[model samples]
Structure formats: C-alpha cells, structure tokens
Target: MSHARRLQRELQKMHQDVPVPGITMVNTENFTQWQMDIEVLDQNPIYHGKTFRLNFKFTENYPIEAPEVMFVRAIDREIPMHPHIYSNGVICLDLLSSGNGWSPVQSVESVCMSIQSMLTGNTKNERPRGDEQFVLGAGRSPRHIRFVYDDPTV
Candidate 1:
C-alpha cells in the first residue's frame, strides 16, 4: 500500500483505539508529515507538567523505513533533558534510526509510547554531552546523524 493509504489506516486506528494516552495526533492533513503531542506519565521531575511536540516526517518508503521524529520548541512545550536527546530536538534512539531496528510493523503510536517509556525510565537530568555545540552547528536531520547507541538500559 502507498504511504498515504497506510497513514490513513493508521489514523483511523488511532482515532478508534487511542492506545497511547500520552500521544495525541495533532495533524494528519499531510501524510508525509505529522504532528503529535507527547507527555511523560511518570512524575519525572525533568518532565513534570511538560508536553512535548513531536514532528514526524515520513518518506515514501515509510513502514519499510523510519520516520524523521524530533521535538519542537513552542510556547507551551520544551524539550526534555535526556542523555539521548539533543538540545536542538534531535533524538538518538535505536528504534528511530534508519540504519537499524526499523521495521515495517512500527507505527507512530508505538514510537511515541517507546519514547514516553524512555523518558519515564530516565533519572538523569542532563542533556547529551555537547548539546549546545551540536544544536548550534548541526544542520542535518536527526536520521542522518550516526548516533552511537551508548546505553540500551535507558
């Protein structure tokens, strides 16, 4: 199936089941790009009362490929401090990497939940090392970066 059709199907399912409470679809007008809101359920001091915006850009090869997922800074939302997340909104997760572990079975809901869980499990209140320099200088998309999966326990 085409990306549009698959997205429509996913959107339909999202509306029907609403599996992930922390994730809410913001826009689905464009299948290639989507917006969502994510919240950390656990009262992690780092993410308390914060709602983060996630931008998901899907390629034509989606499902077979992973979407470009990143946090967006807005009036009500700020990026949470995590070792795997850059200050500029780039996230370093094995599941979202195009180089590995991306499977056709993965959906936006699943990814969002994984991220929520990741944040919930984290105890460190620090951004990835060199986040300032990376955000100011890094101009490429998050998927292009060869981020070293330093910790699987996170």
Candidate 2:
C-alpha cells in the first residue's frame, strides 16, 4: 500500500484507541494533514478547563520522517510543554525526532495518540523543565533539536 494509505489506516486505529474527545481526518483531498481539538481533562495545576487545537501534517516520507505537528490558533494557550515541544505547538516527541528512532511504520493517528498520552499525565503549566529560552526562539518551523533528557532527576 502507499504511504498515505498506510497513514490513513493508522489514523483510523488511533481514533478508535483514543478515549478523549477529538476529531480525526475524514476528508478526501487532504490526507497529509489532520485537525482536532484537545483539552485539559484532569484537574491539574494548570491547563485546566482549557481546550487547544491539534494539527498533524504527514509528509510523503512519514514514519521515516516524523510528521509536522503544531498548535495554531488565535488564542491558543494549551500547547504541550514537553521537553521537546516548541512554543508554537510543535512537539518534539521521540518518534518525531530524527536519529532517535524514526521509522516508516508509524501513522498520523498514532502520533496524535502518543501526544494525547503525553499530555494525559501532567500537572505543570510551564514549558519543559528548562527550555524557556529555546521555546522563545524556536518558531513554528520544524526545529532541528536533539533532546538531551540528561536531567535524570527530572
């Protein structure tokens, strides 16, 4: 099957697996990108009672090359504050990372779900532990950053 087709199938599986309320790509013309909404379900320190948009852009070399994911909106403030996420809502998940372990078998839906899982277990409203500077500098573009989670104490 083509890469697009495989991605679609993977998305379908993700929609089925995700328990949170969100939409999946069901359009015909644009299978490369997906749009959805995610919110702070659990009552945590911050990000409570807030909703954020989720955007996933699959490339022709998806799985092998991580999809371009981001959060875009007028008043969006629910960006994932992970060690790898940028300020513009672009995530720095492992699968999306370059030499870390990117493969061609991943799917758009799975990627989204992975993000959801990452957000599901959090209680902080701040960016990754100590990436305030990078977040301010990194724009929405695909920033090339090899995450160094050296702070095992975190």
Candidate 3:
C-alpha cells in the first residue's frame, strides 16, 4: 500500500490503543497533512501533566524528509526542555530529523513511541542552547522554523 494509506491504517490501529480525549487527527484536503493532539500521560518532571496539540505535515518525500510537526496551542504549550527539542516543540530527535538518523524502515508507530518517551524523560525547564531567541522570534510558526539536527542523545 502507499505510505498514505498505510498511515491511515496505522492511525486507525493507534486509536484503539489510545482512548485519551485529545489524541486524534483528520486528513486535510491534501492527504499529506494531518491535525492531531497528544495528551501527556506519563508521571514525570516539569511536564507531568499537559495536553499538547501538534500538527503533522508529511511531504510527498516522507520517510526521506521527516514529517514537519509543530505545537498548536500557543499559550499553554511551553516547549519542554530536552537536548533534541527546540524551544517551540520542533523536535530535533535523530529518528525524526533528516540526515542524522531517520530511515524509511522506521514506522509511524515508532515515531509516536519515540515522542512519548522523549516527553516522559524530560525534567529540565530550559530550551536547547540558544533557543530563547529562536522561540521569541519565529519558532512558534511551523512553516518558518526549520530544525537542524545536531545530536541524538538528549
């Protein structure tokens, strides 16, 4: 099946595993884009309890070009601290970035799990290096910010 259909099927199965209120999506006119939210459930530090809405925009070159994702809720969505995450939830994880790591063999489920793990592991309140300026500038807008992946371990 094409990757788009595959994603639709996978997302269907994922919904079965997640019954949380905020986690859902609907394909746009362009099947490459989706609107979804991730409700945090892990018991952790700093981000113990929060629901974050994220937009996932896949390119025709998906798997090759990692899906473009961004935070949706501006006020409550404070970027969680992590080595691979920018101040605006633009994740820099190798599994989701361009050349540093991601491969076509990886599935959408793995990506979701990685994001869950990343959030659960965070405990700091700071942004990646100089993300303060980035955040204040144009980090909130997805189309404007492009993440450059430098490190994998966060």
TM-score of each: 0.94, 0.69, 0.69
lDDT of 1 by residue, 37-63 (tens): 999987889898889999999999888
TM-score (C-alpha, index-matched) for candidate 1? 0.94
Better structure of 1 and 2 per TM-score: 1
All candidates' lDDT scores? 0.87, 0.61, 0.62
- Candidate 3, TM-score vs. the true structure? 0.69
Q: Judged by lDDT, which candidate is best?
A: 1
Q: Candidate 2: which stretches are off by over 4 Å?
A: 11-29, 74-84, 129-132, 152-154
Runs in model 3 with CA error above 4 Å?
Answer: 15-30, 74-78, 136-153
Model 2 lDDT at residue 89: 66
By lDDT rank, best first, the candidates go 1, 3, 2
Best by TM-score: 1
Model 1 residue 147 distance off true place after TM-score fit, in angstroms: 0.8
Clashes of each: 0, 1, 0
lDDT of 3 at 141: 43
